[model samples]
Target: MNIELHPRLAADCHRLGQVPEGLVLLQRNASLPWFLLVPATPREQLHELDPELRHAVVERWNRLAAWVARRFDCTRVNVAAIGNVVPQLHLHVVGRRHDDPLWPGVPWGQTLPARAYSEATLASFQTELASALDLTPAPR
Candidate 1:
C-alpha cells in the first residue's frame, strides 16, 4: 500500500527516511533531538491499526527511544502520541537533558523558538540517523 505523509509533518520535519516496517521516521526541526515515528497507514490513532501493525509500531517506538537515549546521552527520553492539534497517528521520541530550556517541564507546551540546524548540520544528522536506523531513503 502507498502511504502518504501528512503535509504538516512534511513542512515541520526533515525526512530521515523509512524503516522496513513502513514507519517513515522524521527529525523535527527543533533542537531537542526529537524524532517522529509515523506509520504510513492513514490512521488517527494506534488502536485503529491491526494487531500486527500496531505491535510493530510500538516496537519501533521503543527501539527508537533507546537509540536516542544512547546516541544523544540525554538524561531522559520522552515518548508520546498526543494528537490534539494534528490528529495524526505519530509517535514522538525526544531526548531530554536536565539543563534544557524547559527542563522540569514537558517539551510540548514550551514557548521558546525551535532551534534550527544549519544545512551542513542537518545533512550530518540525517546521515547519522539513517545509518543508525539502517534505513534507505524513501522517494520524496
Candidate 2:
C-alpha cells in the first residue's frame, strides 16, 4: 500500500497541498483543460482500488467534469484512465471543446502551460466547488 504521486503530478498538485479529507488534488497541464483524480487509496492500479473508493473516484470525476463543462460551456466530455505514463491509480475527466486547440484529436500534445489563475480566481473556484467537493479550508 505504498503509493506516491509522480514528480510531474506532485509539482502540479502543489496548490492543493493543504487539501483535507475527501478532496483530492487533480493535476494536469492546466492548459488544454484536463483533470486527474487522486483517490485516497494507496493502490497503484485501478483494479486494486477498493469498491468504495472506485465508486468515489468515479463520482468525483463525473462531478468535476460536469462542473468544468458547465463552467467552460463545452460541447463534449472525454474521460479516461491512461496509466501508460504514470501508473498511479487515478482517473482523468477531461472537458473537450470542438473549437479547442486539440479539437478532433486527443488533447495530449505538448504545449506551454496556460496562464495560471490569479489568486482571486483560484480562491473563487475552490470556494465555488467547496460545497460539491466538500472542500475544506486549506491548512494555513
The numbered model that scores best in TM-score is: 1
- Give the range where candidate 2 is weakest over 10 consecutive residues by summed lDDT: 14-23
Where is model 2 more than 4 Å wrong at Cα?
1-4, 17-23, 26-30, 112-114, 137-140
For residue 30, give model 2's deviation from the true position in Å: 4.1
Give me the displacement of residue 100 in model 2, in angstroms: 1.2
Tens-digit lDDT track of model 2 for 26-84: 44345555656666665777677778777776777778788878877888877777777
Model 2, residue 52: C-alpha shift (Å): 1.9
How far in Å is the alpha carbon of 22 misplaced in model 2?
Answer: 5.3
- The per-residue C-alpha lDDT of model 1 at residue 24 equals 47
lDDT of each: 0.76, 0.62
lDDT of 1 at 137: 58
TM-scores, in order shown? Answer: 0.84, 0.78
